[model samples]
Structures are given as structure tokens and as C-alpha cells.
Target: MLLRFTTLSALFFAYTLAWAQQSNSLFFMHRIPQSNLINPAVQIDCPVYVGVPFLSSLHLNLNSTGYSYNDIANGTGTINFPALVGQMHSWDYLSEELHYTPVSFGFMYDNDQYFNFAWTERVESKLFVSKRLMSLFANGNTQYVGNGLVTSNPGLNSFYYREFSFGYSTRLRGDVLVGAHAKILFGLAGLYTKRNSVDIEIDALTHNINARWNPQVNVAYPIGVTTDAAGNVTGVSAGAFSPLPFSLNFSNPGLAFDLGFVKPNDPITWSGSILDLGFIWWLKSTSRFTNDGHFVYRGATPADLTNPDAYIDMLADSINNQVQFQHSNGSFVSFLNPKAYFGGTYAFTPQLLAGAHVRTEWYPGRPVVGLTLSAIAMAKKGSSVSLTYSVMNGSFANIGAAFNIGGESFQFYILADNLLAPFYPERVRNANLRFGFNLFWGCKQKKKKLSIPESSGGGCFWTWGLDQKRKQHGVK
Candidate 1:
């Protein structure tokens, strides 16, 4: 069981390290309609906008708090296990986030209010593990003969869901613009652990092992499990069961909300938001598995030290014989990872601005935070270019750039948090990218000021002055 779980985690970590999350680059691009995903208070210049189906927005992010690829692998395509283990913290996390919007549209109403709708699909995954637990698996228990090993709160939380959102933004007193998104969520699949604990001790003289395991896991996926007569799970088959596709899963429902505000004051603008405050009660095709077992193994002898394979096989068999899992159908609840943003911008000119942004995401174990500073240049035709420097996920080499190019009828934009990650993948810990296309209409520009008439050539001003003087003197 330990080997299988470790292998699966390692594979997932490796796969997600190459892909990438909420992008800091997009947070400050107010001209892009999709920027509302980060801060709903952001209002696009166009009076009406529609997102291209399936191509409006795509977001992907991958991050690790423990070690990067370079710390584990050498230049010669060899993995250095000891080096990787040495760089790990007491507790580490690996996370993946994805968002794709299929349909979205917005229109201005009452001249001061905006209303929008969107259908989005999202996936989130996070894995937390203990360093000592990893060391116990990698280096063996010989070093811990008397003390043994104890690990707590090591587990995985992953889920897939769809969101149908209705949003509104309106101007308030003091020229403050406030907005919110009310979302209805449908869960498709999930895997979560409520409790996970492991304790093991070996006698100093006899090397006898005493172990206790208490783990409870909940699953809501489409699969069939095979169990032995003793109620121990032995195998799993995916082809044995069929379920509705993710797009059609409405049995598991939830709700969420996002609130934000933007305050503009001449050259300075302030903005903040709180997003994804919600939970899903999973009641469809859910199963709960729990195992609480304590056992002793007195089969180890001094002679078995020379043959490590035989000793490992003996230990595995003892565990299998002692531990049995209890399974039942039950409902579970999982919460969405919430995030917050606080930021401000300074406009040096009508066409140029500088901004600083702070973002935080609350996960299970710890909160992840990032800071970004950016400069944006806007064109009169509603196009923009931005460059940014960000410090995120323990990586300092993040240099980002974005561009929005289009005319009155259509727009296309691409935003990324770490443009260098693809080229220098070994040096960075995380990467994110968002891109989309949209159709726009009734784009309004800054109204131009009317020029004053010259006094020397003013034919109407002289007559107006003479008429005012005659009226003051009572001579009509």
C-alpha cells in the first residue's frame, strides 16, 4: 500500500510540474473582459462583449512547495533521490489548478450597471505529505530502530466541477464600482481524505515491529472495486462501471460567490476582491473507506538483514494480513479553495499606467502568496501591452508579458505569469497562462475636450458681451 501510494503521488507530481494557475499577469489587465475572473469590479470599455465558444479563456497552473525539477534530476537524465530528499521541508505541497470558460456574455444596462453570464469548468488538486514519512520509505527503518516513525495529516484533495455564474457590477457613491458573481456549482468527481495517521516502532534488541494505521478516504468517481472475502480491497477496474460525463453531472450541487470593488481617484485606482467562497455536498456515487488496525510482526531475524528483498516481502505480507478496510456508501462535502486580492495602480498618462498587486490563496496546510509589479501601455484603438515582474511560489525568476490586440469588433489577448519557465524549466517552481478571444461592440473612448474660440476672431462673443452690457444699463 505504501509503495503504491508513493508511486502514484510521484507520477502526479512529475506530470503537473510541466504544466501550470490564477495568473498574476491577468489580474492587472483591466482592458481584457476576462480579467473579471480575478476581480469582478473590472469593467471593460466596450458596452457589449461576447466570448468565443470554448476559446474565450483557458487557465492552467502547477506548483510545488518542496523541490523543483533541477533539485531532483541531474543534467544527464538521472534522478538523485538523496539530494531531492535533503531539500524537502517538514511538510510540502503539490498543487494543480485549471479553468476553462465555454460560454460568456456581458452587456451594459442603465448606463451605470453591467450584467454578465458565464459557464466555466474547473479542476483543482492538492497533495500534502510529510518529509519523515518519505524518508522512512526511501532509507528504510534501520536508522529508526527504537524511535520508529509517526506521521499525521498527509493526504490528497482533488475534484472536478462546473460553474454557472451570473454577475453584476454598478457604480456606487464616491465613484466606487462594486461587483459580484453568484455561482451555482455541479461536482463531477472527487477524492478526499478526512484523516490519515501512521505510527510504527521497532524493538531495539529483537527488531520486532509494532504498527498502527488509521486512514479514512472518500471517493466519488466512476469505478468498480474488487474486495476479498476478508473485506480488504484487492483490485479496482475502471471498465466495470459507467457514469454520466462531467458535463451532465448535476446530482452534486453547490453555491459560491465572489465580491470585489474598484475605486478610481484621478491618477490612482484601488481594487480588491475575495473569490470562491463556497462548498459542494457530494451525494452521488460516493464511497467512504476506513481502516484502523494495529498489528505486530515478530517474523524478522538477524539473518534476513543480508537479504533485503525477503525482509521487505515478509513485512508487506504481515501488513496485508493484519489490515482490513471497511467500506460504505456515504455523502461528503468539499470546499473550494478561496483566494484574495489587493492591488492598486497609478496612471502617469491617459495611455500608460503602473501597478502593484498582492494575491493570496488559502489551501489546506498553508497559504500561498505572491506580489507583482507591472507597467502597461494602452493605445487609442483599445489595444494594450504589459510587462511584469513577480515573486511567487519561492521563484524569483518570473518575468511576465502580455498583449491585447484588436479593433472595434473583436479582441484577442494572452497573459502569462512566467514566460521563462518553458525555456528554463529547471529554474522555476511554477507557471501560469491565460489566453482568449472575444467579440465586442459599442466600445467607448475618452471624450475629447472642445477647444475655446480665439478672442480676436470671435464674432459671437462680441455680440454676447454687447448684449449683456445693454441689459445691465436697462437699454434693450
Candidate 2:
């Protein structure tokens, strides 16, 4: 029975790893308007810009704290479970997230203030697993006969939602730029664990299994539930399938805010931001599933072990008969994962700069921190490229890169935290990509003064303006 439970947990863990979250490479690329998503104070030089509807901005992220795909699969394309389990830490996590912007636009006001609006759809999921549980799955329970096993509660959290945000930024005293984003969120579906105290213990002498499983899981999804005469949940069924299960839902609403500031001092600059500090209340189609108390089972006999198929069926029957699920409808609150950033940059020249950034992401457990160093080069035509190196999530080989290319009227850009993941996915533990297209207008460029010498004829020789001199000198 424990083995069966472990198997199901492993499957769910794999499913969550398919998608992941967030991109740090976009933080330093100020040439792209999307950079403001991370730091609202980041100002785009253009006076006005509009995203190209669905093609505007799309982001996808996938990562694992324990191991990469290569760690499990061998050259012959077979899984090495023991090797995979050996490389796992005491607690490992798999996370996935996606963000898509269908509508977005921004404009600068009076060369001092900026305003923008966007509507985005987001999906995020995470799973936490313990090393002991994985070991039992890889190696059998017999190895842990003498030394019993105790594991922390393994849980999963997933949700889908939509966000409509309005942002404003203005220059403060001493040219300090400050900004904020007020967001309204509508949650569509979610599966969250409210309480978990599920533990399994094996007796050293008698080989008896004692399991104390009392978990409360809250779900807000569109599905039908089956119940018995006594109101106990018997089964769940999905009547019809939809490609996008939670397309739009307004029943669960919430509010969030982001605050940021940028301070410029001569050739050096400082910036900081706090993002997504808010929560959502799940109220529609919400249900809670929970169990009662403890259950004990004797070790499997020799004959039962020999016929594994029969033993599995017997175990299933035993579990169904002993463990009863109680279902109830109730509303619950879920908080958004918040992130903080603090960084500074040094200008080497008019078109080149170097920067260092520190980011911390807060979760229910421990906060994940990362350090990134980047070098950026900009062109006069509103184009730029950046290269970065980051250290985070216990994996150090993070080489990030970003580029923006286009004239003043249109632009296309791509930013990635780990470019190597696409080629050698099995070798890297982190991967994220953000790409978009936008139309830009009224990009202001600084006008340089021309130094012309006076002729011997006196008074003032005929001299052209800076713009005319640039044309005569073949300057762009």
C-alpha cells in the first residue's frame, strides 16, 4: 500500500516538472518594454508602444531542485532509478509556470511620468518530495525493515488565474524614478493542501505497518463528485474534456501590488523592487477532501509477495475499506508567491554598462536567493544585447543572454536565463524563456552640439545645425 502511494506521488511530481517559472535575464534589458514587468520603475526610452496582441509576450519556465533529466536517463534511453535517488537531497522540489500577455500598451507622459496597462494569464504548479520517500520507491521496503522511515509531509500546489494591471511611474526629487502596479486577479482553478500529517511507520520486530494519514486538500475545479448514502465521497468524474479547463472565471477575485524605484547618480545607478504581494480567495466550485485517523496492516506473506498483481488488488481493497474520505464545500485563501530584487549598475560609456542583481523568491518553506552579473551594450537605434551569469537553486552553470533588435517603429526581443538547457536539456537544472513583439513610436534621442570654427572673414562663418552636420559627415 505504501509503495502504491509512492508511485502515484512520483507520477504527480513528474507532471509538475513539465512547466516552470520566472526569468531573471529580462531584468537588465531596459530596451524592451516588457522589462517593466519585473521592475515597474524601469523606464523605456520610447514615448509610446503597443504589444501585438497574442504575439506580444509569452513566458515559460521549468526547473527542478533535485536532479535534471540526464541524471535519470542513461545513454541507452533507460531510467536508472537508483542513480537518480542517490543524487536527491533531503527535500527536493519541482516547479512549473507560464505567463501570456494578450493585451498590453504603455506611454510616457510629459517626459517625466509613464503609464501602462496589461492583461495576463498565468499558471503555476509545484511539488515537494522527500528523499526517504524516493528511496522507498527506488529500493524496496525490506531494506528499511530494521530502521523505520519517517518523512515530512509531501504536498502539491497548483492554480490558474488572470491579472489586469495598471502601472504608473514618475520622476521624484533628484531624478529618482518611483513606480507601482495595482493588479486585480481572478482565480479560475486551484488545488491546495490546507493540512497534512500523513506518516507511515514500519515495526522493526513484527513488520507491522502503522500509518497515520489525515490530510485536508482544498480544490476549486469543474468536476462531478460521487457520494454514498451517508454523504461520503466515493469517486470523482470528469464529464467532458476541454483543452483549456479554466479559461475565464470571476468568482474568485483578489488584489495585488508591486512597488519599485530607480535612483541615478552620475555614472552609477541603483534600483529595487517588490512584486506580487497579495492573495486570492477561492470561493466557486470549492471542495475540501479529508480523512479520519490511523490504520494498521500486517506485512505481506510470502505467497502474497510472489503474486504481486494479486497482492496489489488486496492492498487496494484493504485501503478502500479502512480509509473513508469526507467531502465538504468551503472557501479558502491562497497567497501569491512574492519576489524581491535589489541591484545597481555602472555605466562604462554612453552605450555600454555593467550591472549586478540580487533576487529572493519567498515560498511557504525557505526563500530562494540568486545573484546575477551582467554586461549590456546598446545602440543608437533602440537595440541592445546582454550577457549574464547567475547562481541559484544549487546549480551554478547558469549562463543567461538577451537581445533586442529593430528600428524605432517596431521591435522583437528574446530573453533566456539558461540558453544551454535547450541544447543539452538533460545536463542543466534550470530553463526559462521570454519573447515578444511590440510597436514603438516617438523614441527620443539626445541631440549633440556641433563645434564649428569661425572663418577669417569675421562676424560668423556660415555653419550648419547639428542635424545638418551629421548628414554632411555621414553620421547615423
Candidate 3:
């Protein structure tokens, strides 16, 4: 009863925030999402006050753990759910969130590939207008929604998920900037299977079943037909020759926010290095709502099997009432969105920069701290290279090199991460390689700074229209 009630409540909350809560952690460059300790505006590679850049990035992440599931068969933890193995069960999310204008659009995909020949896929897309739009609705606020799951073959392969987010920033004064993001969520699950079973009527209190049926257990049984005592018809199962695994799909979106600040160098005062700081606030996270029902196939009498619809109604009714979910199952953890870090970049020399950053993520209480060192060679042209080392439960590192032609006309880059993983997975390692090229089709020179004149204000002659007034004053 407790489990059922909690599941229902999760479903309710998920519905309330379904489109707002999502996770996109697959990309390594998601510094803003992974570590919210710095103002994203300041991190823009292009000149500020300019247009947003066109950007595309791809990232692949892999996670695995070893454990035993006694409930399945002895303590073996064999693949009872074949489709839930390998890629399907791997917890990784993908997103495209860097776009132009005050609005942004992002798509996220997550899947768990645990068992071979079985798989799950989830896709999510988000559209964000300025949070200022909140005033347009009542309470001066409105919720955002995103889609995160799709089931193609149904029972053979299923996907599940949750996501939500929002961000904002404004100028406190010249050189001081602040911003934040908020998110909300909900989720659901779908299941499809080639095989099924039937349970016969028994005393509700005693829990003694009078009969039982197993649709398929071995290659001989397959999934097309079932028999009774007289070898009579019981169930019709198709798709046996094609052999598809049972599948389920779920989606949830939630709400969270991030606040940040940027303090750039001040040439007139202290020539100090640029400083970046950020804070993220995540709340109201919910999980997926797997339908709570036992299904039935052909030839099962009403008394022979419990009504699947009744179970669904009961769960829905529980949702109508408020409740909280439990995480007793494997891989389930205490839920809360964690705050993270995002500040870095300190210049040690005219051509050299070094910085450090730290961030904490939810679900596993994992903390990552990293340092980056980069240098540009002094030459007629320009060349630069950078190396980053991150330490967490495991150590991760990356190396990147950039070459420039004619100072700004042409550029080439090569980047790699987790190079050490190939040498050691258990000893601590991870890696990837990336390359990029950029060129300008047209050349335009920067305009020279103009000098303004200062008049009777006793300021420099190049202030406002002061140059003309200075001539008049000299004549007088």
C-alpha cells in the first residue's frame, strides 16, 4: 500500500512538471549545466554585446557498476530484463542547449543499454523564452515543458526519463553581472512484452493460487500459444519468430534554477584577475509513473486473474491524494537536485592562463574538481595549447591544442579527453578526441577608438564637444 501510494503521488507531481524537468549531462562542455559556479554570459567565447554564436557539440559518457540481484535467480543477477541491460540501463543524458536570442531550444536523449539485443531510447526538446515572460501569466509565472521519451516497438524496447530548467541574468552595475535558472518536472512509463503469465484465483487473505501459467521460458515454448489441461486455447502470442524483448518508456520534467556573477579585470584600480561565481537552486524533482496493473491475455476467466484496470484505478486514486515515493529498489537513491561550481580562468602571463573549478552532482554525491592550464606562444602568428585534469571518485583528464593563421583568419583545434582510460578502467581513466576548424570568408578591420572632446568641464580636450569649446575659449 505504501509503495502504491508513493507511486501515485510521483505520477501526480510528474504530470504537474513534466515538461520542465530534464537532465542533459552527456556533453563534456556543459560547464553551465554540470557546474553552475560561474556566470555563463562571461564564458561566451565571442565578444560581449555581440550576437550569440552558432555552436554544436557531441559528447559520450559511460557508467557501469557490479552488483547481485538475489530476487531474480539465487544471487546471480542474471538478465531477467534483457532489454534493460548494457546501453539501456546506463544513465546518460544528451542535450543541445546553446542557441541565440533571449530564447533557447535544446534536445536531450538518454538510454540504458544493459542487455544485448535489448535497448531503450529517450528524447527531450526544450524551448525557453526569457523568464521575464512570467509576468504575462497569473502569479507572474508560468511553467515550461519538454518531451524526453519515445517507444518505437513498444513492449520489445522501452525508455524512461525526467527533466526541467530555467536561467536569468542582469547587470548590477558596470562590470557586475548576476543571473539564475529554475526548473520543474513529471514522468511516465510504457511497457511492451512478447511473453506474459497468468495467476488464478485464490483466497485474498491466504494468498493461495489455484492455478498459474507461464507464456514462455525456453526456445521451445516461444510466445505464440498456451495450453490448458485439455490442451485447449489459453493465450495467443505473436512475434515469436522475430523475438522482441518486453519494453517500457517513461518521461518526467522538473524545475531548477541557477544564479551567477561575473567580475572582470579592472585596469584602472587593482589589475586583478577576472572572478566568476555561481549558485544553483534545484527543487520539486519527481520520478516516472509506471502503470500499476497486472495484465491478462486470452482464455483467462475473470475469477482466474485480478483486473489490471482495477490496479490502475487504485494507483490513480492514490495520485489524487498527495504522497512521496520510496527508493528501495536497486539504483534508486534519495532524491534532491545538487548545487554545483563553474568559476575559472586566471591569467598568469600575457600569453598564459591557469584556473581551477569544482562542482557537485546529485544521484551519487559525486564531486569533481579540475584545473586547466593554457599557453599561447609568442610569434608573428599564434599557437596555443591547454591541458585539464579533473579528480573525482575517478580521475579524468583532457588535452587540447589550437593553431591560428594570420592571427585571426584561420584556426584549427584538436581536443582529447580520458586518454588514460584505455590504459586503465579500474585503475581510474576516461578519454575522447575532438577536432575543430574555423575560417573567415570575409575580412573586416576593427574601427579605431574615437576621442571625445571635453569643454568647460575642465576635463580632457577630447571629451564630448569640448575641443570646439576649447578653441572658442582660446579666441575669447
Candidate 4:
């Protein structure tokens, strides 16, 4: 049975791959709106900074859904278009509508650390904003009449959402830095439709079906179909696709926060740099809100029971009630619970920094080491280019570079990660490129001189707090 399941999954994935080729408007990522969770510290100088930069990054995310007890026995088949199940009356009346989309394009600006040297102690902060578009696709096996076997058929199309987010961060003293971000997400941007289309295939029959089956599949499910007063399908309806279990036209607004610290020291013989440690946690993400209300079936005549429309109402109520489609109520919900990732950076030299990060969720499971690498660079004090080659886990490797325009008064920088799109430190080669740039302007003041007894450092530790007496008598 496991072998059979694996074979089915393989076929589904392959079908998805082929189907993806035809989907031009599908979103490929879901983490776009929450990219600030990666690295919050973008260079923090004296506030105002700007630079023109473009980047692209691509990665693949796989999730398991739609596998109910029935799916286990009949082969996993979940429908993306509720209208298909509605038209065919295939859904069992009491199951929540399942929505599952795989792959999306994730990209962000300002996903790094910003070191501040303007204050007494160097200040640091992280800032970022990003968005991802998710693709809408369905995978499952279809059972034909007169056939005891099932075959996997994956359908992919232009279903997706757009997200916008902004984050800010800054350091406390020289050790603690805190940051947070909020996002506004708008979903279901691409609408598609397919109806009354059929394709007949002449192939070797694996299942023993002597009769021809309707191979017509709808590409986009229409939102509201033409229906009689009693809610029976009256004709093909047209408009925003409806009965699509998930609401695409809703907005989700949520917030996330990050706190990190680094203890810098001149331990041993290392100079100009020290060890840096940090930890980050993300609160539960908010989900798009939609109407849970159902459509009420209306009939004027008492004989509506046998009027066809009445019976359709009964089915609609059963299926519609059982399967709740998410609505666009302009509100929000929550997706995953709180999660966290911890990491550390050790600078062995002014031009070389090494670090590793581990990710864990509150749920019981092994903590996964996302990445580790040593960053190396060569340059003078005013200008330098650094490269970091890192591996997440043991398989994926990524090469990143950051160039700085440094001086006494101010500084400027540009960075590129996954200079190859989508391929990050964790993934060998993903599609999409990720890049960012920043500018900093600051002025440092010279340390002030204080008159005190040579025997005591400035003032006695306790006497410095005595105000008038300490100022008049000094450290006598």
C-alpha cells in the first residue's frame, strides 16, 4: 500500500510539473509577506537611506493536504474548483472544503543586518519587506465508471494572491536589537474559467471501461451560476469564480516581531571583531477573513419539493453547510502557530564572519539546522567586497556578496543573495534572485574629558551618583 501511495504521489507531482507549464499567472510562494522573519537587521545608520536595487529568488514548498480516510482508500484526489464537485455533486455533504496550492514566488527588500557605529556602542537593526504570489493547483486521482482502479490527474491554473509588508528594527545599547513588521495581503488576483469542453483520448484501456467517460474539465469555476429561485442549476453562470472553497478577494493584516542580541568581546587574539549571537521568533500569522454565511434557498410555491429546485436546495444545503468556502470579509484569521529560529555569527576577522542558524517550531520535532557558513572579504577600510558561501543542513549551498562604500562621515552598501533567483543557502538551485542595497549617514562625536583625581577613574563609582557633593569635593 505504501508503494502504491508513493507511486500515486510521484505521478501527481509529475502531472503537477506538466500542468504548471501551462499556468502563467500562478503564484509560486506563500512566504513573501513574511520575509522579515528571515533576517531583520539591514544596515542601520542615521535613519534616512535609499538605493535602487532589483532581485529575484525562487524556492519550492511542498505540503500535504486533502488526504482523508476516504482519500487514503480511493487514492488522494482533492478538487481545486468547488464548481466541479458542485456540478458533479461529488463532495460528501459534511467535509470542510480543502484548499491546497503548491509553489509560489517569494521575494523581499532589506533582508539583512545593518550595523550602526554612530553611537557610543555600535547600534544594529534589521528591516525588510517582501511579497509572494501563490499558485492554485489541485492533485488527486479520478475514478472512472466501471473501473475499479484510479489514476492521478493534477490540475494547475492561474490562482494566486499579492502581499505587501514593511518591517523595522534597531539595537538597545550594544547587545539587544528588536524589530517588527506588519503586512497587508490581498489574495485571489487571477481568475480563470473552463466549461463545456471535452477531450477524448484513444489509449490502451487499463481499467476495463467499455463506455466513454466525460473528460471535459473546467479550468476556472464561475462564482455564481444561473439558478432557479429554488437554487437549482439553471444555466452556465459568469463572473468572479465562486464556490471556490478559499476566498481570493480578501485582505489579511498581521504583525510579527523579532529580538536579537550579540555579545562582542576581544577574547584571545581576535581583533576588530567578535562573536555575535541572535534569536528570532514569529507570532502566529493572520489569515484572510471570509464570510461563513451560506446562501439561502428561496422558493415561492408550496409544490417546490418535487419542483427539482427544492431537491437541489436540500443537496446545496447539505454540501454547502458541510463544506464552508472562505469568504472575502475584509478581515483576518491565523494560519500557523508561533514558531522560532535561533542563530549565531562569529567574526574571526574584520573581513571574515562565520555563523549558523537553527529553526524549530513549538510542536514536538527535531530542530533543523537551516544553514551555516563563513563569509570572507578583502578590501581597504573605505571599500571592500565580501563573499559568503554557506550550507544549510548538509546539502544546499549559496554564495552571497556585499560591497560597502565606507568613510569616516558616512557609508553605503549593496548586497546580493541567491544572486541566483530562488536558490538560497538551503536549496541548491531554486529559481528567483534576491538582492538589496542600503545607505547610511552618521556623525561621531569625540569622547568628552573629565577632571578627577589620578587615583580614581573619573569619579568614585558610588560618589558619581551624589550630585552636588561629588561635583564640589571631587574624589577627596
Q: What tens-digit string does per-residue lDDT give for candidate 4 at 189-232?
A: 32211111111222234322121112222222233445446443
The 0-to-1 C-alpha lDDT of every candidate, in the order given, reads 0.75, 0.75, 0.27, 0.27
Deviation of model 3 at 188, angstroms: 8.2
lDDT of 4 at 358: 45
What lDDT is obtained when candidate 3 is compared to the true structure? 0.27
Residue by residue across 1-476, what tens digits does model 1's lDDT show?
55457655655554345434547888777778887887887666666789988898988887887667776775545655566567677776788888899899887674467788889998988897767767765666687897788877478999999999899988776657889999999998899987467888978887776878787889887667788887778766553344545558799999999999887665567889999999999998888888877878785567999898989988788777777777778999998889999998787665677999998988775687888998988775668889999887666778998898983579999988788888978756767888889998654333443122222111111112222322322334
**Cα TM-score per model:** 0.86, 0.86, 0.36, 0.38
Determine the C-alpha RMSD for candidate 1 after optimal superposition of all C-alphas: 8.6
Q: List the candidate 2 regions with Cα displacement exceeding 4 Å.
A: 1-5, 11-21, 76-78, 136-152, 239-248, 444-476
Deviation of model 2 at 153, angstroms = 2.8
Error of 3 at 67 (Å): 14
Name the lDDT value of residue 368 in candidate 1.
78
Residues 273-344 of candidate 2: C-alpha lDDT, one tens digit per residue: 999999899998898888775677786889998999999888888887777788888999999989999897
Cα lDDT tens digits, model 3, 15-131, are 221111111111122111221212322221111111112221122333211111221123343323221122121121111121111212221111100000101122222111111
Q: Rank the candidates by lDDT, best first.
A: 1, 2, 4, 3
